[model samples]
Target: MQNKAIDFKRQVNIKLADTKLQDALSRLQTRFVEGRSAVISEIHHLEDTRTAAAAIRDCVLNDLDSWLQKFEQQAIAHGAIVHWAETATDANRIVTEIAAQHNVLTAVKSKSMVSEECGLNDALEHAGIKVMETDLGEYILQLAHEAPSHIVAPVVHKNKEEISDLFAEKHQMSRKTGIAELCLEAREILRPAFLNADMGISGANFLIAETGSVLIVTNEGNGRLVTTLPRVHVAITGIEKVVPTLEDVTTLLRLLPRSATGQSITNYVSVLTGNKDAKAHDGPEHFHIILLDNGRSSLIGGEMQEMLRCIRCGACMNHCPVYQNIGGHAYGWVYPGPMGSILTPLLSGLKSSPDLPNASTFCGACAAVCPVKIPLPDLLRNLRTRQMALGLKSRQEVLMLKVWGWLTLHPRIYALATKIGVRILAMMGGERHLLHTLPGATGWTDGRDFPAPSGKTFREMYRKKSTK
Candidate 1:
């Protein structure tokens, strides 16, 4: 996938102007955010659960190499093959090779985020293999040729009416206005794909090092089907997903579904250990797990290591003000919202995605709701610091910051400048008292007006209070 993250502001502009996209994103907050808030109280001790979850993830990050090795040894012992990938391209190539080796005709996917990061669909198509997305949101995106807007809810940028139209056109069937009718149409169309697909691909929620099992939770039963029925199954996930034990997985599961979809438990929780046994007649014949680094290893023992704790729950984005307006596509990558804002630049290159670090309001809402207690705001600030240190900021912005720093050093002059600037702003406002446009800030006022200062500066107010 060509990265549009480089065009952050441009994409944001387009997403903001799109009222339909706005309406679609609003539903994300209503359904996910409100639902999460309502269900969190059900946890015996929400904070304690979050703490335990964070500790388990941090424990893995502390010794990720050992756990991954343990997982590999255990998985292989159980008849599953483990592959390591240093880059997204490497992971894609590995998957393609496996598909070719098996003479796979059709590949059915179960919404793997790492696959999106690896551009596996494009790579498979390039290799002359047919790829089918089994997950409903991913299937919709596969038909639309659009990237996902959110991590958990990939098709949040789309509404039912638009999906209905797409389904009718893509399925080449008569339009179905009702949601149930459209779902049935998709099911009928996809059932054949499930039965005929030679290979299955999915993303793992947690890789239990103790049992060497690939655990994934889904409301839709496609995860189970994609792993089964097909002769070959491939599970791809970031190396950070590995945990020490199933008990740790059990702890994380308490937070994942609740934070992601507000469900106390997902309808289907599949723990796939390996291929079918000689005595058994079910499960995939060949099971492969791809552990993708893709820049994750570099963050180990660093300022950004906390980022690896992410479970793709997407609570950060659901409550994000920026995401609520611009949606995920504006982030210009598969990962979106606060997590994407940090991950895109970290996993991809900062030079390619310079605007992502600054795409936040520093609201800390993302950090507050993060189930694993990732300090997202602090990490975002770290990226901004790195961005500035690397000369990623424009000359004008750098100069402005320098000037502001100098003014801060001289309080009297800074106070005088602010006082005069406010008076000038007030004069410009006239009777309307709203500044439609201001100096040095362009396009910002295009959408809304800024209120002119109505009183003295904070310093002046403080001095007056002291005198009183």
Candidate 2:
């Protein structure tokens, strides 16, 4: 993962400077914004649903242990083999063992973020299994040998032309310019992989404890096919995905799609109960469920426990200004955006991902749009504090912040520094009241001009007013 982080940062720096990537990201971001706005505008009870969803998630988190046990019992009764994986290694071993038992040479998979979290694809491929991604976005990324750039829209960073070029190169297909044509081409190429796969892997959207069912919501029909067509089906989910009942799952269903893609409901919503019975026409013969702990259990009683409430809706990322500017690869993980800022450090370890939590501007846009009400900015700050305690912050930044803190504590020094700074900026800007370039202000001035501070400090005016 550490190596992946470094590689991701390098890729993002290259991708950010590419004009094609910028244009693609801009168009994609705009579509999401407009679509979500349209949905919110039409839905009169959006906020109420968000509140109700948040409450449901909160209740599940509060009683996670009980719910997990109940879910396991129900799933076993429904003929699903339930496996508890307390670590990534455990999770990988469980999946690989299942695949080996079935002599699975090829596996067809839907987009499961939990699988990404566990590095399941690479693990299986390493064990000599062929893994094929069925999602169109995921397929594009797989061909490019890249991780997902966004949670919902995995290849949001790629333009159609880029995809056309990739397909022509990778699959020897003709250059297709139309979006629908490209999708059709991918579908045709993946259809064979699906029919030949010995195992199917998918991520659960929500796990219903009452009935021990795995719920998956997707726009493409591939998710349904992947789970039902193969001889063996495996569902990978995080511990946090468990809910008390189908009713609780309904509350999340109302908010997730609107926050995610501005749709009232995704095109396909599948509820799977264990394996197919003898009378069932079509379904997997064997069913397995891997519940991943992966450090999430530790967070249950900690300060950042609220983060477990995230539904992976990608709303926080969609609305975040930082994510809008830099995109997901900049955060360098399976998760990105505001939710990623908090989750990456907790799951990946704070010392390695110090830059992630500090990447936010704390503008609170993420929290405002989050349907589950995760306090992203606050959690990021908390992670930053923890990082500092661990001495993971750079020396220069620490010193700078300490000096700033000291000056702010001393009113006289702060006032004097502000006056001097204002006068210097005013002199530099002259009548324009703006600076295009300033020493020690390169980061701020690189893209946008900085407005010069007023000649007089607010403290001076306030002092005069008080005296009068």
Candidate 3:
């Protein structure tokens, strides 16, 4: 993960200068933000709903032990096998073992970020099983050998023309294919995979503790097929996804789509409690649920606990100034934006991604748009504090900050330094209000000019006015 942070700085430089990439990000981010704003306006008491949703999440997280135990008992009663994974390795091994035991040659999967987090496809393939992604965006990314740029809109970074080229090269389709035609071709390819797959795996939007059910919402009907058509169905999700009741799920469902894709409701919402009952013969006969902890449990009583309240709506990224500039891939991880900034360090360790928390401008746009109202800016600041306390920052940076702090505490020396600094910069600026070059800050001056200070200091002017 530390390697990823080191790469992030390099990637951001390239991405910022790519005009085509910037254009695509601007258009798509605007669309999502506008759609969400419009839908939110139409809903009555949306803020109240957000508050209630936050409270419910807080309740479940506070007493997670009780909720998880009850959920496990109820799920077992419903004929679903429950498995607990304390780490990503455990999760991948569990899913692979299930495939191996059932003699599953092929597995079809819906959009599951948890699977990405655990690297499930690679694990399954290593065990000699074929895994096919059924969601259109996910399938496109899988074929291209790329990770998702956005949470809900996995391939948002890609344009239709690029996709047409990919399909033509990989699927032997004509390069002049249209958007609708590409989708149809993908459907034709995936339909057979779905029918032949011996195992189906998915991620849950919310897990119901009362009913022992997993709720999946998607625009495409692929989620329904993945959970129902195969002989064995498996759901892998974070333990934080569990809710106490269906009514709590209803409140969250209303916020999920509206905040995620700006829809009143998703096209498909599949609720699977167990596999098949006595009357049902078509659905998966064997059902399994894998609850993954993967560093989430350690955050329960910590400052980052608020991060667990995220619903994965992508609203924070959509509104983030930094994310809008560099895009998600530049973050170099499964999650991105303000949520990713906090989560990456917390889950991976503050020393791993020391620069992530500092990536923000602290504008707080992410906090404003977050459905669960996680104070993202505060959390990010806390990460920075942790990093500094751990001495993770470079020695040069720490020294500069310490010098600045000492000067700030000494009023007379600070005033004298500011006066001298203003005169020097003003002399350098000459006729211009901006400095095109600055020592030790080439990164800031390389792309844009820095404002030059005025010739007169505020303290001098204040003294002159008082004497008059």
Q: Give the TM-scores of the predictions, in the order they appear.
A: 0.98, 0.95, 0.97
Ranking by lDDT: 1, 3, 2
Q: In model 2, which runs have C-alpha deviations exceeding 4 angstroms?
A: 1-15, 463-468
Per-model CA lDDT versus the true structure = 0.91, 0.87, 0.89
The window of 10 residues in a row where model 1 has the poorest summed lDDT is: 452-461
lDDT per residue (tens digit) for residues 1-468 in model 2? 332443444555576687876786687668777677778656568778778888888888898999999999999999999999998889989999999999999999999998888888889999999999999999999999998978999999888888999999998968898999999999898998888899999999999999999999999999988998999999999999988878888878877888899898899989899899999888999999999999999899789999999999898888887778777787878898889878887887776666788778899988988888888889988888887888888888789889999999999999999999899998988788999998964867876788988788998889889999
- Of the candidates numbered 1 and 2, which has the greater TM-score value? 1
| lDDT of candidate 3 over 209-266, digit per residue (tens) | 9999999998888998898899999999999988999999899888888888888889
Best by lDDT: 1
2 against 3, candidate with superior TM-score: 3
The TM-score between candidate 3 and the true structure equals: 0.97
Q: How many residue pairs clash in all the candidates, one count each?
A: 0, 0, 0
At residue 437, give the lDDT of candidate 1.
93
lDDT of the structure predicted as candidate 2:
0.87
Q: How much does candidate 2 score in TM-score?
A: 0.95
Best by TM-score: 1
